[model samples]
Target: MKNSFIFLFLLYSTILFSQKTTDYLLDKKEISQRELNSLSNFPIYKAYEFSDKGGVYNLVLGENQQKITKKDTLNTKIKAICAMNDHGGFLEKWSINDLLEAYEPKETNIWFWTKYCTLKDLDGDGYIEPIIVYGSKTEYGEVRRVKIITVYKNKKYVIRAVECDLDYCRSFKKDAAWNTLPQKVKTYVDQLVIKLRKEQNLLLKDG
Candidate 1:
């Protein structure tokens, strides 16, 4: 018990000091030229896809999308996620330099994904749970994190994050290994949080 308590204390202290990532803005002129280039053409990144799904609970779309009256905006966000299939996901964008730029380049290059996932009711009480699947490029590998951002009855949350990367590979390995206890076979999963990837005309399907 004492050992567990000490371990928890250490873990809490680490989280207490952790900081959200930041996304720096390049000069519009500098960015314009690079934006024109293809995925293979650009080296330094624009802060979105290049990041390995590291941010937690960021409201880049703002919480307004989840508002009942704001259904239009919510649809827009979903449409955008569905559109990632065209010409690769290199065009995924989140330029927050105008309002806030607290997003760090390395930490998450994203805002609003969670350090640890939590549950929420983005979908109404009775309905197929709605979700948002974000696609992007990461240093280690592809990163997809699902989220349900909705505010119901004054309760709002950022929930459901399933990431695909080397860092979280252990959690995935453990789960798969447990199921195949008798015969050990390496379970390789590089895409864990991806609801859809590289599927042409993906928008035609439900998110």
Candidate 2:
């Protein structure tokens, strides 16, 4: 029994250590970057299912997807995945461009944007930096946004979201409780970098 238990533990550890976190987005299973870019310009792009309840339907800049709307028959049945799972899902059929514009109040009821990441050696290290965007909407209609960047010794994922209104919206940018942009973003980015480094460390140790 002791030998059997030891063998099983070793097997589990081996499998766990062997797992590598590859880029799921760029993996061989899905469409290529060039194809995705081209499809983003399509008038009505098919939504790709990332998880069971989430997928993304791409659309052209000036066009719209009639299938994506508040009154659509399939709205309740489909979960429109954000470009990245780290980002959040949508609530209403706001204008795509509006949400895609900027992180502001007036930009509500339109589109969503996630291109505000700033990459620099924030820690004064001699290495290129990486930061990414993440945003989401809960079932209760609260918005969660996070920006993350990271390096070796430190990591974090600043996260913030709350029920929004006219009063809250105006103060969203400056409010400490509701805004998680710089801090949470930094956290998540750091987490990813640490994870990548750990994976590399394991690979090198094995090699």
Candidate 3:
């Protein structure tokens, strides 16, 4: 009887773990106005929604313009990626903002690389890590800068890179905490860096 009980307990544990693994897997979902209202406390002048997992994540992109002068306006962009439990209790919120120089003849553009932004339970912690990427570049795409931001638990890791064909300059910076992330997470970020480089026609490999 004791042996049977032990076997059944182990089997139940295994099944529970499997179910959790499946539940934490991320999937894309359509955005809804109700979800946007929940984030009204944020500075959401103009917003784009990327909600997912039955409202478990209220990821959104908020944008606004600040008028500096009659001929010049500064553009501000924000990303608010929030994680919540099944009961709608907030777990963590990752917010980032970027400001573009006042408008000029140079023509600057700033935007989130929405296709690269992803949510995953890379460590199987039953909570998803959000990876967000954005960039700003000149009108002709001569000089470009990209930023990759990812949050694990309440900690954030970032990578900043600049690519310029006009001056043949390429460089990148990693946050000091980057090395603290799990090997699997590091590998995932590296792969994304490679993809972003390729898309921009960068010749130098990521260091």
Candidate 4:
């Protein structure tokens, strides 16, 4: 009995020490420029195909698309994840400087998307003060619901994103090591959050 017990313990330990393997495979999907230009709150499958389009392809449509209702808006808060960052993503490369400039309608690019969020001023403030997130599933990966908050500042609605899925965050890792387990897979959630907050605060202050 003692010998059998020792063998079982060693076996169990070996299994425990073994490295974990992931099933996540690199999805080769292409994104298009036209799709990117017309992107809203509709989920796209095979986002890798449209990756060139950039930004999350997932969108929230229908009544949810019209305007973020009050109930859903309240649930948009990050809740206990403040240490990391807010879910609404960040602005694109070109838009960063534009956002810093004075808020204006022409300056607002509805197509602009960031890991932090898609912003809009529903009430039509020169500034995109409202934060919102799109909640839905995409063809290539999981999709998150949209969070819309209407901040009553300057007698207009400011749109901003409050939440989005961390799983959707991904980037291309070129190194051979990144292709294997443990090294390649990392959540852009934290980085996205930081970037989003930094931009969010900046936009808010200016708006």
Candidate 5:
């Protein structure tokens, strides 16, 4: 029994360490640059058993040439895979552009922006930085660069930005955020009128 338990533990640990994260949008399955935006897009696998509530379904063929389908009607019964998951209703029809354009500060709060903006503590500064993902295109959807404004409470200096995609990720770079603009990212920020500055930056208060 002791030997059996040790073998099982080793097997489990090996399997867990062997697996790596993936992004369905990319064909290669592996990339050097790790982006926080990939968190929202998780992996989905198709296996046995039929679920009526699920959005994705297909005809299954087994031994003896049997045909199995979840629903009889395709149009009315079948739902988009995205519609059933992550997407809060009608998200199946919307695109990345729609999400960026729809990020209203008052209507959708910080919790809601995780679908587009990801919070990460890559700098080890204790404070999590908001990494905003702009679009959802295969070739060029993710924003390679962004801005880091120093925020203050009462004229006290805050921590500096240590991590960045390039010079843009550094602090006090002029037109840094605008340099690697996503399609609607400029308009989206402009619409909100966020006051980001070099010395002190203010958060966009919920309207």
Candidate 6:
């Protein structure tokens, strides 16, 4: 009977330890020369600093540009986002590559919507969730594609949308796993999408 009680106590303690929460804070930081050198492989354009129970973390966003030599001069753009620990070891990375094509009237443009990128513990989880938003546009900017990528617990949730005008999105897609997220996290992301659509003037009929 005493052993059974001890077993129960230990199990309870283990559950509490596994669910322990850490406070995380994120702030934009100037990239030092040393940090730049460390990330020399990436064309880093922006960076942020954050810390939790584990240690400090650096998050960076950049693009890899390569010239496309065809009939017309173009470029292949690869947007890269990464997070590294204090030891300079990469923790997570996300990337998307797209080819710049001449669309007769206008060329395709792809970029990160840095203003909406954020790091937060929306679900009150010990881990910080990194939310990244980016977009691509062609057809003389008449058609736009927006994407939001959020990483929680090393798992990614994605939301993709095609913007029509300035009122609603023409179409939107959410990963199946998105529906399984905490309600608060889902709400926060939904608000972010609304703000992005309104601020960017990318509204569709039934967005």
> How high is each candidate's TM-score?
0.22, 0.26, 0.69, 0.19, 0.21, 0.66
lDDT of each: 0.28, 0.32, 0.61, 0.27, 0.25, 0.63
**lDDT: which candidate is best?**
6
* Comparison by TM-score, 1 against 4, better one: 1
**lDDT for each residue of candidate 6 in 100-196, tens digit (9 for 90 to 100):** 4453335466666778887776776556777888776664655466778887766779887766544433678889889888898889998997787
Over 4 Å off, model 4:
1-48, 51-64, 67-184, 202-207
lDDT (0-100) at residue 207 of candidate 6? 56
Quality of model 5 by C-alpha lDDT: 0.25
Candidate with the larger TM-score of 1 and 2: 2
| Residue range 9-80, candidate 4, lDDT tens digits | 999987655423211112324224323312323322212110111222222221112224564321111210
- Top TM-score prediction, candidate number: 3
Encode model 2's per-residue lDDT on 78-124: one tens digit a residue.
11222432244333222122122244432222222224333344433
Q: Estimate the overall C-alpha local distance difference test score of candidate 3.
A: 0.61
Q: Tens digit of lDDT per residue, candidate 3, span 12-100?
A: 98876654322232222333433553553434433332333234455556545433458543344544545443455445455676766
Displacement of the residue 61 alpha carbon in candidate 1, Å? 2.5
After superposing candidate 2 on the true structure, give the runs of residues whose Cα lies further than 4 Å from its correct spot.
24-207
TM-score of 5: 0.21
Among all windows of 10 consecutive residues in model 2, the one with the lowest summed lDDT is: 73-82
2 versus 3: better TM-score goes to: 3
For model 1, the local distance difference test gives 0.28
